[model samples]
Target: MTAPSKQTVCIVDDDAQVRRFLAEVLASVGLVAEQHASGEDFMRRWQPGKAACVLLDIRMPRISGPEVHDWLRDREPGLPVIFLTGHADVTTAVRAMRLGAFDFIEKPFNVQQLIERVNQAVRLATDKSAAGSGNDGWQRALTRREREVLRGIIDGKRSKLIAAELGISERTVESHRASIMAKAGASNAAQLAAMAAGQPPLD
Candidate 1:
């Protein structure tokens, strides 16, 4: 039998140095890292269903990371996208996460953390591909309140913020969050966010 192909991680950044460094790091972990010098370059070269995950730089020229993410959402809804942002870009990154990004890593990130997040993203992508429409069951099982709380969590909102928005107590929001996780079989918010990607809007 032929061996399974390595998972590909596409790194889209304006800085050549950043792309090279990320390529080296991902390669060290047995992942195939495809580097793109700019968002436009990535857009041109990217093919649907080609990459398991994307490491997108948030502050790129022209297309920008969020813009590229929008394109990805429309084209490859199931592909995980992890934004690479600087300290100042954290807010923007969080907003992107709300829109279905897998996760975000701030600049000067720990190598181990990056590897863990990337691995998680790859696993999520692989599981999603294998499951096909299987995820629909869990999604259908979520209560409307659970779904609303889940949308807040995926948006990177704090429990307090979600509570305020929903006009419920923080404890209530936490309860909904726990229920959502249990129903979705997700151990954490990141996994929940990944599973929710491309799903219908909770609203």
Candidate 2:
């Protein structure tokens, strides 16, 4: 019998035992884990195209997970990361979430849940990278007035300030913002900003 081809996963941690255990867990489910000793080690030999998802340890000997996350964000912003932490605090989890981590999982967690999130992250990455389709659908989805409102949103103007700038009511500005969020498939103002950053600012 032949073995199934492994889906590559990059595991970065300073502990040999932890790496081996993670590698073993991945291999159990027909996935392959490439172990790196530190954030520096992973960066030096980072291959962007191969790995499906990077499972990173938040606390390492030298470079930390958040640092590596920043590095990847600057270099390959599309890369997906799932942070593995021994210390799970509200602040840490919130910070990691803001930093675009797929999930912040504490140590001694259910192996199955971790794998499930990793699989979903891989799929999301695939979908987001595959086809962005047309910006026209997105543009047409916004009303003329909404586009005008969006310009201020992209320019970092507050809703009240935007209303004052455009000689409109704050309620009207909020309505346009809601419309913009729905049209762009973005959940929050920051997500709208990210989507706008991927395109030209509304003219």
lDDT of each: 0.78, 0.71
Q: How far is candidate 1 from the true structure (C-alpha RMSD, Å)?
A: 7.5
Q: Deviation in angstroms for 27 in model 1?
A: 0.9
lDDT of 1: 0.78
**Model 1 lDDT-worst window of ten:** 178-187
Candidate 2 C-alpha lDDT tens digits along 100-199: 5556678876888887877765654454434255653555545578788888888888989999988998866765675455445455678778788757
Give the candidate number with the greatest lDDT: 1
Number of backbone collisions per candidate: 0, 0
Flag clash pairs in model 1. Answer: none
* Model 1 lDDT tens row, 1-203: 11134298999999989888999999898899999989999999988777878999999888899999888766776577889999999888877765567778999978999999899777766655554457565666566887888788879899899999999998677656644553454556788789888886344
Error of 1 at 68 (Å): 0.7
Report the error of model 1 at residue 154, Å.
14
